[model samples]
Target: MILTLTPNPSVDRTIAVATLTRGVVQRATDSRMDPGGKGINVSRALAVNGTDTVAVLPVGGPQGQVMEDLLRAIALPVETVRISQAIRANVGIVEPDGTTTKVNEQGPRMSADEVAALLAAVDRAAAQGLEWLIGCGSLPPGLDGSFYADLVRRGHAVGAKVAIDSSGAPMAAAVAAGPDLIKPNDEELEELVGRRLATLGDVVEACRTLIAGGVGCVVVSLGGKGAVLVTADQVAHARATITDPLSTVGAGDSLLAGYLHALTHGADPATALRTGVAFGSAAVCLPGTEVPTPADVAKIDVEVVDPVDLDLPL
Candidate 1:
């Protein structure tokens, strides 16, 4: 089973319109509300695909109730830690041209006792035959970046492979803890390394440096340019077949879910990359933070290419 810890989860509401004019009223074209935050999205996608998984998070107040209700409606298993402060409800406005404007609320502030309870919940979840523990998304106020670092250590102590998807100081600290895997988009990758990764080789070298520092593996997502995977033994590239996209939210989380699902089932490096990118590509064709199901992933054509051009422009 895969376990996920979303320290700050949300209820995402996405509205669609013909165009977004700054000072003018607009009529809606469509709308949706889904469970948000990176780790929660991954668990949602995994549950849809019949993968055994559970999401552990902090929830409180009415907004938190709504978030929990949404997850239950989708049958995503959750182990919620009750917090004193309410979580957030984030909004997104999507245009017909796939332009997205998002406003995210600063989620709840947890007390010291609440933080300890949250970690204890994750520890309990990890004890239940969990294979991977994914710690993701931005840290809420009052929690230091070391939160993820501590979580990684706990997961490792339980023999679970920890994969982190976060940014800034939180990401830096987690990487230093030597996570089993990390999925950093181009911007996050550049930010973590403090350099301009203008080429595929530059990205590869950056990931290699992390591996040398004890990180097990790194996956650098290049948006439309596809994704690259770097390990101590191999560096490979995989690109997805493009499609008319509706929204880009939750695509990266879907990629991580697919890759982990395949990996735990013994798929090779290239095959895992293919599945990961396929799921991500499929997610872009859906609305809101919708995750791609197996059918959606099956329709996407992606394969990790050999003789990966190290100098490929990102």
Candidate 2:
């Protein structure tokens, strides 16, 4: 079983509009509300695919209640830590061609006691014998970059492998803690490495540096350019052709879910990378933040390349 912890969860409302103008009233073509945050998205995708997973997050106020109701409506297993303030509600505006403009709130400031309670909740969940503990999403106000680093230590103490999907200081600190895996998009990867990674070789070298620093593995998601996976012993690049996509939001989360799902089921790193790309490609074909089911993933074909073309521009 895998346990996911979302530091700043939200009620994500996505609106499909013909066009978005800065100062004009517009009618939405479609809309949807899903449980938001990286870890929550991963858990939701896993549960949809019949994986044993639990989502742990902080919920409070009316928005928090709505978030809880939505999770229950989907029959997702969740463990929520109550906070004093209402969690954030994020908005996404999508066009017909799958271009998304997102407006996200920073979320409420978590007090010292609330932060401790959140970590304690994660510890309790991890103690239930999870195979992996995934710490995801952004930190709420009042939390420092060391938050995910602290979680890595906590997960290791309980004998659970930890994976982190985040950016900025939180990600750097977590890297120093030597997580089992990290899922970062191309932009996030560049930020973490503090350099411009314009080619596939650049990405591999950056990941290798992290591995040298004790990170077990690094998975970099390059939108449309596919994804690259680097370990101490192997490097694989996987991509699937996706045409006329709907939305790109949460695609990376689905990729992480597919990769972990494969790993837990005994697949090798190369096969796992293919599965992740397939899942991500499938997600782009759907609307809003809707996750793809097993059927959706099965229809997509993935290609995994070894000795990747270093000159391929990202």
Candidate 3:
């Protein structure tokens, strides 16, 4: 069973407008709401793809109840820890031109005991037999940067491979702990290594540096340009076949889900990367956090290029 932990989950409200204007009232043409959070998205994607996934998160207040009801309505398997504060709500305004403006809440302020409770919940879930553990998204208020690191350590202790997708100090700390895999978009990758990445060579160098630092594998996702996969022995570049862009939101999460699913199913790294890029590209072709179907992935053209050894500054 795949277990996903979301420290800061939210209710996502998406509104569609013809255009966004500054300091003006714009009527929304349509509105929709769903579970919002990185780990939630990953679990949803996996579940849609026929993978058995359990979404473990902290929920509280009426808003949290609404979020849980929404997930249950969608038939998602969820395990939640009740907290004191209410969960957050994120708003996304999508323009007719396919541009999306997102406003995210910082989420609830978690207490130390609350954080420990969630970790304990993860332990319980692991004891029930977890094949893979995925720690994704940002740390909520009052939580330490090493939160995901702790999860990685615990997952490893339970003989489960851990995959992390996050940013800032949390991501850095998790990488230092050496998760089995990490999916960082181009921007996050640049931030992690403290440098500007302008080319594929730059991305490869960054991945190599992370691997040398003890990360098992690094997947750097480049919007439109596709993704780069780096391990100790090889670095492969996979490009998307479909070029027509719709929405770029949630593409990275979908990619991580696809890749993790493939890896868990015993596919090689190259095959997994190809599947990931395909899912990512397909996601961009759809609207709002919608993941690609296996049929969509099968139709995508993915080309894996030879590893390029570029001299880069560590």
Candidate 4:
């Protein structure tokens, strides 16, 4: 089973409108609320695909209650740490053309005791054993950046591979600890290496640098251009075309989930990349943070090639 920990989970409310005009009244055409956080999304995607997975997160307040209700509605297995402060709620405004404007809360300021409780909760849940322990999402207020890095060491101690999907200082710290896998989008990759990546070569070079630093593998998602997989001795690029695209939220998480699902099922890295691209591509055709199931992904086709063309523009 795959275990996922989301440091800052949320009730993500997505409102769809024809056009977003500032200083004007607008009525939403549709809206949806989903459990939000990178790791939670990974678990949700996996669960829908018939994969064994568990989600671990902290919860509090009315919004936290809503989060729990949503997870229950989806029949997702979750282990929640009760925190004193309420969890965050995020808002996304999506236009018909697939333009999304987001307003995210900073999340509650967690106490030191609350932080310890969360760590303890993860330990308790992981005691049952898992194949992969994933630490993902942004650091909530008052949480240390080294949190995921600490999880990496803990996962290794328990004989489980660790994967991280986060950004900023927290991600940097986790990378220093050498996680088994990391799924960073092109922009996040640029932020980590502190440079602009204009071509596929730049992404490969940057991923190689991370592999040299002890990271087992790097998966870089390039949005519509597709994704790249880089390891110590392998490089592959995979892409899928999406017609009638809707929302991009949680697509990357679905990609990571697909890759992990395939890898755990004994698929090779290249095949896993193709599977990931298919899942992500399918996700884009759905609305409001919705994840696709096997039926939805099965219709998608992914083209994967090793020895990627470095000259390809990102």
TM-score of each: 0.97, 0.98, 0.93, 0.98
For each of the candidates, the C-alpha root-mean-square deviation to the true structure, in angstroms, is 1.1, 0.9, 2.4, 0.9
Instruction: Give candidate 4's whole-model lDDT.
Output: 0.92
Candidate 1 global TM-score: 0.97
Q: Over the stretch 44-148, how does candidate 3's per-residue lDDT look in tens digits?
A: 888888888888999988789999898988898888999999999888888765688999999999887888888888887777788889999988888988988
Q: Score residue 131 of candidate 4 by CA lDDT.
A: 90
**What is the C-alpha local distance difference test score of candidate 3?**
0.85
Candidate 4 error regions (>4 Å): none
Please give the TM-score that candidate 4 achieves against the real structure: 0.98
Off by over 4 Å in 3: 241-244, 306-314
Per-residue alpha-carbon lDDT of candidate 4 for residues 81-101, written as tens digits (9 for 90 to 100): 888889999998998877788
Residue 188 of model 3, lDDT score: 97
Candidate 2 whole-model C-alpha lDDT, 0 to 1: 0.92
RMSD of 2: 0.9
Candidate 1 least-lDDT 10 residues: 240-249
For lDDT, candidate 1 versus 2, the one ahead is 2
Question: Between the candidate structures 2 and 3, which one is better when assessed by lDDT?
Answer: 2
| lDDT score of residue 292 within candidate 3 | 80
